[model samples]
Target: MKSSIRRRVLLLALLPATLLALSLGYFFTLSRITDLDQALRARGLAIARHLAPACEYGVISGNNQILQRLADSALAEPDVVSVYIMDRGGNVLASNSLKQSKLAGIQPGDIPVSSQNDTVTVATRSNVLFFRMPIRQTEVQVDDFALTSTPAPAIQPVNAAPLGYVAIELSRKATMERQNEVLRSAALLTIAALIATALLALRLGREITVPIMKLASAVDKIGRGYLDVRVKLGGNDDEFRILEDGINGMVSKLHRAHDNLQEQILQATAKLSYQASHDMLTGLINRREFEVRLERALFSAQHQDREHALCYMDLDQFKIVNDSCGHVAGDELLRQLTLHLQQEVRERDTLARLGGDEFGLLLENCPQDKALELAEIMRKTVEDFRFSMGEKNFMVGVSIGIVMINHESDNVVSLLTSADAACYAAKDHGRNRVHLYQMQDSELAKRRGEMQWVNRIQLAIAENRLQLYFQQIQPLQKQEQGLHVELLLRMIDESGQCILPMAFIPAAERYHLMPMLDRWVMENSFKLCDAYIAPDSCELQTWAVNVSGASLCDAGFVQYLKSHLVDNPALARTLCIEITETAAITNLGAANTFIKELKSLGCRFALDDFGSGLSSLNYLKNLNVDYLKIDGAFIKDMADDAIDLAMVEAINKIGHQMGLLTIAEFVDSERVLLKLKEIGVDFVQGNWIHKPENAEALCKT
Candidate 1:
């Protein structure tokens, strides 16, 4: 049980002592004082009554001596200041007073009394009480004392009239003196009690507050992460002791939890560090980690007179496995190939998976010949390794490109580029081979040129330097399809010279940049149509713009077209979107979805370079298209070669059977045009039909 602070404070302070003294002394003093005043008043009234009766006879008889003796007797009692006996004519017949001057000429009969008690009136002022009694004669009823003399003549009927008055004054000095003495004793008792209470209160507060303040200091330390702090309090069976035990227990638990959390944090940090630098798939360092180590290797080779070799390895026939057995088999094959390469490489070499089907090896402190030997061994290991998934077994090979690193080596970028160029050269020459990087290799120069073209193409697109040209798709049948023109893309170099599409288009497609180019063409073509041709004025003038396979697969391109048509829906009618035959078949689902969505917006689709694929007719049946432009390879030579002529005639017939209009491209001569018309091809587009012209010419017209 906890000790009560209320009980302890009351016992020590003893407040009831002061309160009892104040209350009892006050009431006791007041009672005594009241009794003294009442006694004075009672005495005054008794004197007045006695004097009145005694003065009545003297007043009637006009005897001043008897009245004076009676007044003097009344004044003699304690606290009686003055006594007066007056006659009916308001004359002071006799008076006795302690202070004669105080009573001289004072008419007690004229004084208004505050209260009337029958024949007596009492008035008190200034600690003095006045008592007045009227001396009225009453009829006396008395038995005869002698010889029964006939009731003593019936005691003679006395007149009931006031003959005179008697008044007495009393003093309150003695009562006031006793009350003051009682108050002084009460004040002394209160002061003594207060001094004792204050001393006791100080001791009690020290006992309680010291323990509480000590506990508070310990708790503050615990709050500041000092888990070892514990409250040490000295008390038996008290709340402070119980509270101290609870705090110690809680801190102990918190210390253990904090230690456990610290260990867990360290373990998690190590795991995350490993995951950040290594690939989870093959347990090998990833490209970022590989590049960091390569940077170090380059520094050592440049400054420390060390020789290192970097080999960029690309797996050949990787796509065949992915295409044949899906990505699962491809992944398993890569894992197995990683193990095989690891077994052939030295422990000092750093092997990393650069990206999909590409791996990089850094052989530090190695000669060129030893690097070559090691590269060949790794190539042969991968070439001979067979990855088996269930009943299917696959053999894949790797092409190795080795760039020797020495003090003469360039930076990381140059070394990586040279390695990659050499790897490409090995694949180009023959698969499962090793090639050393050389500065003057023609393949490396070509690769570098293509890289330069990639940058140039990006810059050209940023600067809006791509131009559009139009070639007329002349209709051989002369139908109601007003006019159709195919738009061609050309690039304006930094020198402002127009570069043909063949120069940059292959590079753009190789780098998956065709989608950006396609969007640019579509946006500008709509703008050109809006400015030059009104929808109502030339409703049937269709402008055909080519869209690439990458653009067809991209869902964003579909939304781009939708948003533009939503703003100007009529432009869809004037635009014809052309897609190559191979691109359509490669991404058949996305292409079909793309074609259907745009075709619903009044846009027409033409299968460009038709009959280019092996199964063109089979794929064509599934594609929803309005036109098929025969592959120019067949059309350009159909005039001279029989096989080309037969191919063109067969494609035109098949297109018509499928209810699609056929257009022949590369119709360079009039003979080819006449042959296309005879073959029932709906359109012929080439220099012979109409030389290509700048699209801006249409705006001028």
Candidate 2:
């Protein structure tokens, strides 16, 4: 039961009864006591006034016997305890008690008279009241009496007015005795009434609380998972009947709601599980689920000592399909393809969607030859199947790369990389074909993996792990000439072994980590050049650094170059930025912008690997460059091949026409160098001049 309702009803039934009884009792009892006190005060005042005249007459006549007689008359009253008389100037003239000592003198001005009736309480005792009254004299035959005393009055004025005051002291013992008797009787009656009311309230409360307690216990049981429990309200007409009805209604509604909520929860959980394991569009197993199955398949193959092949398939021209037919058609085609591939594959084989337009097949107990045969069949199936989108019918082809699981390759990355490389080779050789991974390809793949490690190498640079190696790029014609050095990036691995950039650069570009790696090389390269480059050399030959395409596009590159140049202006002019033709051609706009901005700062640009990519005459005309590096490919074969020599000659002629100096790369033999010199190449760099070596080793050479 709620205390608020119970308390409100109790107060309504009991508060007025308490107040009326208290008011009636106080009015009858306390009012009578107050009236009695007023009567006593009036009687005491009357006695005091009647004796005041005689006392004043005796004081004026100087009669001690008469004053003592008047004091005795005032004390003869029922409640008067003592009395005193004082002159107008506040000197005590006589008293009924203390004949040897006069009352302490009262200053007339200090006396207060009541404003309502000129009555005052002259003196107070623990159980008595004292009053003072001023005596006025008539002009006819007023007697002036002087009383004899032990100490004379301080002064007496000759024209002094005859004034006196009567003091009355009333005893309080009788009043206190009456008040105590009344309070004792009232307290006894109040205690008896409280006991009677408490017994009656206890009986009434039990009548209501017993049913309420039963209802509360039922509610608690229902709250603690016993939904079937119900309250038994004994009185059908009471408030508990309403409470019991409400509880039953709530429990019915809760049961219906719980069933509905449980159904919804189960449906939502199933939907989430489906979305987690399968692709939303094609309804095929997603990459995460596919990888889980692939890992298991690989482990089984290893345990059973049987061959298993993982073929990664990617759709060719899927972007074109999306662009032409829209993503809706693309999604429909993928769904159709998934169904077809599922039908074509063996029941035991696993077909999964790796990502957008990419699929994987896990063939258990299948050799490389069998896996290749299946991959070709899948490719043919895709090529032969005609897909209709709205009005157009088209055929799609796939590139498949297969990796056989073996004891040597146990990790997912290794297997995936091998498959990816084979896929790339298939696409490169020509799409719509299948390629098997080979051991020789693993070296290239391993190099690519190391390039991925380049990102970690860049992080190492920030942590000061990038060190420099200087190699001489000498002129074949003049050995005495101070050779300009090319700066090589060397990473100090965790084991303290040096790793060269050739082992990591390609991976850095593939993974888009080249910008950070390039910046590290630039900052550290300049710092090393500033510290190690000799100032006394005649030419003050520059140090060369290769920059990435991403770094070329960096908006901060120009500012970075300007700040470094500002720090070392002369050495800045001696610093050369080497860029490959591939990087220059890929992002021509940004490359031009960066080159022009830095060239204006007195920095030189060297076109690295000149003949390796699509090095057009248009780029040479548009790009303001200082050096043309003949690609190492032509120089490596220059000694024995006539085509290589002719290509070099053609490049030299083009460089001279463009007014750019030409440098031959990969000058690995004396004959290649002589051929380069004959071609009028301005510089040469290869093992023939000097192989890349540490700074200390370069200096010693």
Candidate 3:
């Protein structure tokens, strides 16, 4: 767990000492180079001091040849490349060089003169060194040169006069070469020591990383579910050894957990799936699962030319027993009937409870007549059987409708609708019998009417024949402003008159066309909102547009809504999205995600038709909604009914507890509004509050 194999610990261990040694040697070599520079300057000064006195005799005599001969002698010294004699006026008198060096003109002010020691000037160019010194005639110079064969004590002057100057140029190649040699030796020694250190470091790295490598390998194994992996390390009492002990202990615990986990995970995963797709009270698949399988069967029939039959079964008198003997007896009757019905079908066939007293049967590879015969048998069996609950006997019958599945069965809805109509038709004629669905039948003609509405709805959406109307959601408290509005969609009928959703919404929803209609209402409502409203201190305006559950099921619909929201900030800020409690409950996870994504853009969500589902209260906690629109059925009669009033009060209290605003729908009278206000309901919607008006009317305001 500490780290992977970078060997940084080993490298860091030796790094400081290596750097100290390198830095010490580097700085020492630099100091030696500086000392050599000073020594070269001293050597040049000595050479110039020696040559100046010799040139003094020549300068005083005004003889160029004598000066040249003296310069030539100076050039013969070690490292001397050029020699020059200049008068006190700073004019070059004589010069000698092995490589023909040119010296720049010197003037009187350029050469600074001094008395006791000849001032030395040093200049270097192109690796050649120049040293200039003033030539002073002191103690008579070389006039006594021939007279004093007795050495002359290196030209000590008693009184010196400025005669001329002498300059010498020397190369520093030899000194530089010596410095390079020393540096090379030091580098060689350092390299040898570093090699020894690096070898020691590598060996130490191997010793340090060996146990870590084992731990890493064990971690890899554990990541792949091999929890039995453990570190086989010794008891050294070191940190790595302690880590090994900890890892081994963790592995032992995980191994026990993994064994139990392996046994339970599969069952837990199955339970989750079953809860999502099946009714808990019955062992049969729910509507969503049944539709999913039906869609699959239709695809099979279309592609592979397979034959199947769908039987729609509705219990004739199950509600009678449920009302007389209570829900427990009704549940017992359904469970007992499910067992008998399940036994009547083959192992390959699927028997599903489609809610309430209704069930669905899918018979694969069965002929039309055979499916009908099987349906009759189920009907007769249900008619003959009597359910017993603690000495109370109950009888129930089932109406069976069988429809053949073929390539012509295009979708699950069409097949289910046709089968359902046939079952209802059977019940209309008689209580307990099997009926077959026919295309030319009156039941099928009614389905045709719904299908015709599908085309008209599509036309209405595309042609903008759809109109938006806003019904005000008023705060029951007079102090509170009712700035919020819910958008209602209206379609132009064949007679060119405005028609309510009741005329076309059922067909639209039944045929999966609500998504399109919902989109139309939302788009136009936002357009109207952008045109009409501006957010200000006086109001925080919001227009609520209903989002269909079908739209949430579409993975692309959220993105589609987001595309519009991204382009229109005003609409995103002022619009509120409303979804039915049933729709939100049906797609709970997706609804939560949808609300969150849009809410982040400054949009709000209202749970409309609230308290409609059996599990409505359970969903409200997880929905993260802004408004709870109480179901109209409870609110419409709340003023007359005590139970309805109590229910409204309870919902209002719960909504407030969850930080939600409660809106009561269908509050068409002042009496209902008074009751709602007493119950602390936040908002109300009804014709009495504000009649639905065209969304375009907002633009006029």
Candidate 4:
């Protein structure tokens, strides 16, 4: 503020004063030059008038010497550069000039000119004035300075005619020198005055900027979190006083806010730390922190031969409690049950809430018997506990699985795998019981492992954690065109591995999870291929998503699809639900209805894994599937086996007769693709054709 004010004030004071001084000096100098020029022109004219009449007689008689002498007399003046005498024909009769050397920087060929008349003058190339006057053949006036003729020179009559012209070149060097001198003096005075004004402005600027600089420094400190910083300014200006007071008040308020902010930060950090490790309601360690401890237990078992026992416990009737009462009641029941469960275990035992109704325990140096005993105790405690919400009371139970952790339990997967399996087996047999894992029994272990996947697949679909894998179905023959990719569902384990559908599909099918999973795939596949769905789709692209048999038999499932797909007619046209050969065979009646309803709605269907079953060909006639994906088992060996090749050829012929496109799976070589093409298969898909890639990579919205 202070610097700007000083600069502006000084400029306002000095700019016009400087310009006025220079302007007055310029015009005064110009007026002086003009007056001097008029005087010089008059004097030159008088001289020319005197010389013109004297030359009239010379012009009349054409006496060259007389005219030349008269011109020479005129040039005797120091400033007179050149004088010319010309007759009326505009030819110079005689002319004289000062020595070329005396007229510094001027060329010898320079001549005076009169563009108008005697009054007209022009500047030469150099700084010399050029002028001309007419030489009149008239009676001469007897002046005091003129040569008085007795009867006045009657060589020509007065105002009779202009015999010739007289021209003169005058030097203006002295006039220019005077103008330069005045300009130099004026410039020196302006510079001196501006220098004084600048010094005065700077002195004033410092007085005002001192307080403002101090305030800016305070503001900078406050911006850097120094809330206590204040500006100190001493000035007679009322504005400075008000500014100082405002700054001090602001700093005071910020100092208070800083204290409150630090308290908030401390509280927030503590809350975040608690939430990171412990469950909010039960106050037990969460899954992440519990797993971290489980990892340490695994390391101890592997390296130190330390034996431990881990129990995976799940509340069996907790869902019933949540359904009967509200979630708040369920939370209260879980909180109270946490206390009873904690009382059943020793202080050294680590317990954690895995997720939802599941909990885990790590027992150090415990044998299988002790683990079973503890697990039973926990199960019995949960069975005996009765939870109450308002006037209603309910009983709950827990299923516990006890697994022995020893040197063999070297990894988190093995320990968790056994404990989770045992717990699920307990639930499978009956709730409110404990089961000990039998490690040496492969059948029990396999069943336990697979049954556990039922819950995992259910959770994956519910959580939308399943991803899609895509394999391009390329045209084997020239009949098929446009993009056609088959959708394959994939699951990710907690360890972040892609678990193949073969690993968990049996569990999903047994537990009736595939209907939910099939719908999940159907919806997400359309969503992923959203870019390809358009009313004006020029290319025929197909996305074949696999469907489960249970979904095929569900009567309401077709309507469920209709509800979602009706809003997206373009997407419906591109969808192809692939039903396995076995599924379609078993549910042929329902499958036919489902296929017909969907086909009418512009959605297509495919008989997936076509030749895996011997009766697949018989069932094909009962269903109206649009495409037949010949099972890979037969196609993979068709190149070497004659029966397999015959089967492939027969399927292609049958499918073509049915007006259905035939796609051969597991085409792992160019030879296989050629054989499939020779068999007249419409499409072939395998690693050799196109590797199964992330579906999002090939189809993204």
**TM-score rank order:** 1, 2, 4, 3
Candidates' lDDT values, in order? 0.83, 0.76, 0.81, 0.79
Query: What TM-score fits each model?
Result: 0.79, 0.69, 0.42, 0.52
Q: Mark the 10 consecutive residues where model 3 has the least summed lDDT.
A: 109-118
lDDT of 3 by residue, 1-26 (tens): 44547457676757975897798778
**Compared with the true structure, what per-residue lDDT tens digits does model 1 show for residues 1-701?**
12455456656556665566567767876786678777777777777777777776788788899989998888788888888787766678888888753445656545667765567888767777778787776566665565654644343325666787787878878767766776777667667767777667667756776676777778788889998887787777478788888888898999999999989999999989998899888889999999899999999989999999999999999998999899998988888788878887798999999989999999999999999999988988887899887898888889999999999988999999899989988998987899998788898787777778899999999998998898878778876646677889999999999999989988888778898899899888887887876656655477889999999988988998998887777778778888999999999999999988998889889999888789888899999999989999998888899999999989888888889998888889988888888989988888988888888776543
lDDT for 399 (candidate 4): 83
lDDT for model 1, please.
0.83
Clashes of 1: 0
The RMSD (Cα, Å) of candidate 1 is 5.6
Which of candidates 2 and 4 reaches a greater lDDT? 4
Task: Output the TM-score of candidate 4.
Answer: 0.52
lDDT of 2 by residue, 292-316 (tens): 8878877776677767888989888
Q: Across residues 1-701, which tens digit of lDDT does each residue of candidate 4 receive?
A: 55576577667666776677667767776777677767766666677667777887899999989999988889886468888777776677888777452333323234445454533444454676666566665554455665554455334455755777677777767766766776677667667766776676567667766787788878988999888787879977899999999999999988988899999999999999889999998999998898889888878888998888999998987888788887888889889999999998898999899888899999988877787788878888888898888888899888888888778765787778778878777877876888888867564577776778888887777776799888888876775556787889899887788888999988787667888888788777767766533434535477788888899888777888888788878778888888889988888788888888888889988888888887876677888778988889889888899999998898889999999999898889888887887778888899998888887677342
Distance from true location, Cα of 547 in model 4, Å: 8.0
Most accurate candidate by TM-score = 1
Using lDDT as the measure, what is the rank order of every candidate, best first?
Answer: 1, 3, 4, 2
Extract clashing residue pairs from model 1.
Answer: none
